[model samples]
Target: MKTILILYYSRHGSVSQMAQYIARGVESVPASEACLRSVPEISEVCEAVADTVPDSGAPYVTLDDLKTCDALALGSPGRFGNMAAPLKYFLEKTSSLWLSGTLMGKPAGVFTSTSSLHGGQESTLLSMMLPLLHHGMIISGLPYTEADLISTQSGGTPYGPSHVSGSDSARPLTDEEKRLCTALGKRLATLAHKL
Candidate 1:
């Protein structure tokens, strides 16, 4: 079976929800499976450290996961139009994999969630793609062939899947957003088989 690692860092739970939807999409494909993993919160204190295991949600990701996965789906909550610090910190540790080209030629995709409708979701998704591109992974985005990509008014993008969680971050994903997320995951898994 092909393993598509769904790695994400979600603070307000929106992105995490998106990850689950994406995993559903991945698993819908024959011979494809999703591996959901998340990164721990980063602390500003020099000595502060997160626990080895997270209390809830997906387990913390490891470098070995990156090296072993057949494909990748990266997700994050937008922070000032960029990926959150915790996810960035984890990617920085991937230099060893980058040097060895462990992720080269792998099919990958990105996703994000934002509080506002225009809350930099695309930028955040694009930013997450940078490291994967450097690792030589082929990037995939939601194609217009997906009906939701054309009809989605809440959150969905050609760059990838996205969600607009609202000001209080309490809004659940709209039906369109959910479909788009699943579409991206399925697309990635399908591409992995072709590649």
Candidate 2:
């Protein structure tokens, strides 16, 4: 069976919800499964240690998970239009995987949750893709062909699936946003199967 890792870091719960939706999409496939994992908050001290397991939400992600995933659906809460610091810290540790070409040719996609209409969701998604591209993963985005991509007023993008959570970070994902998230996950799993 193919494993699609749904890796994410959510500050206000929006991105984590998106990850669950993406996992639902991944599990919809006949022989594919989703492995949900999350990164911990990064401390400014850099020498600080984190608990091995989070009290709630997904467990901390490991290099083995990243290296073995057949496909990846990355998610993050928009932090100044980029992924959160913890997620970045975790990704920086992947140099060893990059060195071994462990993720080469794997299918991958990105997602984010933003607070405003213009809140850098696309830029965050694009920046997240940079590392995946460097690792030789195939980047996939939601195409306009997806009906929601055309109709969404609340956060779907050609770059990837996104959700607008409002300034208070209280807005739930619209139906279109949820559907698009599922669509992106399914698309990644299907492509991984093909490749």
For this target, which candidate reaches the highest TM-score against the unseen true structure?
1
Listed in order, each prediction's TM-score against the native is: 0.98, 0.98
lDDT of 1: 0.94
Listed per candidate, the RMSD to the true structure in angstroms reads 0.8, 0.9
lDDT of 2 by residue, 167-190 (tens): 899999999999999998899889
As a TM-score, model 1 comes out at 0.98
- For model 2, where is the 10-residue window of minimal lDDT? 41-50
Clashes of 1: 0
Q: What is the lDDT of residue 51 in candidate 1?
A: 99
Error of 1 at 83 (Å): 0.2
Q: How close is candidate 2 to the true structure, as a TM-score?
A: 0.98
Full-model lDDT for every candidate: 0.94, 0.92
